[model samples]
Target: MSEKRKLAFSKANYLIMIAGIIVLAIGFIIMTLDSEPYGFGFLGLTLGPIVVMLGFAIEFVAIFYKPKSKSDTE
Candidate 1:
């Protein structure tokens, strides 16, 4: 059996990941600032980690998953 090749990430994917990180940072800052309870800031606190984790999951999927080549179907 032949070995399969790994997929490589595109430049756009990296840019998206970077943007996600920036958004996550902003969310964290908003969450940490003094603010009223049960408000937008509190929402940020809940959303920040979820957004960051989603970003990482997207990156992981991009890096590890690929469609099989036509030749591989034989």
Candidate 2:
């Protein structure tokens, strides 16, 4: 891959990681702030973080977790 391609991939990976952290934080805040143990608002709050984490996980798989081809090793 070219240098530009590597840089672009790195940028995307960081963006996904940051997004995941933000989502997890939001979820934690919502879950903590709720008066009720379980409610729609609380559920909604949790969903944001869950989706963020999933996005991060998917990005991670696409980036750092992929199996390397023979060309990649060379």
Candidate 3:
């Protein structure tokens, strides 16, 4: 008999990935909204990139995240 296989990622991981994508989009939008020429101002040069990096970090965490199984909880 063949055994059923479980998914590699859980629902929570997918949600976290979606959140990371949204954050990345927001960061790009922020950079676009910068008033300075050629995106040289703080938002474009600093804050936007920071947010983007954070988004990437979130995505990394999501990819590696492992939820505790019921057996582990008990």
Candidate 4:
């Protein structure tokens, strides 16, 4: 039988995705920790959103990033 084609993401991609998810979760947590009324504190109003955007950027990069194979490096 012919070998099945592998999926796009390699191990590094998976790792990056997991890290992105963790970052995203931390962003949510940071937002929740805000003390100002209606979550208007720094963590919520600024830092949290920035972190979330960073996480999303990471995820997007991970999805598009392709590792070089030995043959490709030649």
TM-score per candidate, in order? 0.47, 0.44, 0.89, 0.91
lDDT of each: 0.62, 0.59, 0.95, 0.93
lDDT of 3 by residue, 1-74 (tens): 59988788999999999999999999999999999999999999999999999999999999999888899977
Ranking by lDDT: 3, 4, 1, 2
Q: For candidate 3, give the lDDT of residue 8.
A: 82
Which 10-residue span in candidate 4 carries the lowest summed lDDT?
A: 1-10
Candidate 4 has a TM-score of 0.91
> Using lDDT as the measure, which candidate wins?
3
lDDT (C-alpha) at residue 42 in model 1: 46
Q: Model 3 compared with the native: what TM-score?
A: 0.89
Clashing residue pairs, backbone N/CA/C < 3 A, model 1: none
Model 1: lowest-lDDT 10 consecutive positions:
34-43
Tens-digit lDDT track of model 4 for 1-74? 69998876899999999999999999999999999999999999999999999999999988988888899978
- Per-residue lDDT of candidate 2, residues 1-74 (tens digit): 56553353555566666776666676666555656556456445666457656666765654673434579877
What tens digits encode model 1's per-residue C-alpha lDDT throughout 1-74? Answer: 59977437556556666766676676566556636565455445566556656666766655655557689999
- The local lDDT score (0 to 100) that residue 66 gets in candidate 4 is 88
* Full-model lDDT, candidate 4: 0.93
True-vs-predicted CA distance for residue 59, candidate 3, Å = 0.2
Superposed on all Cα atoms, the candidates' RMSDs to the truth, in angstroms, are 6.1, 6.6, 1.5, 1.1
For candidate 2, give the lDDT of residue 35: 64
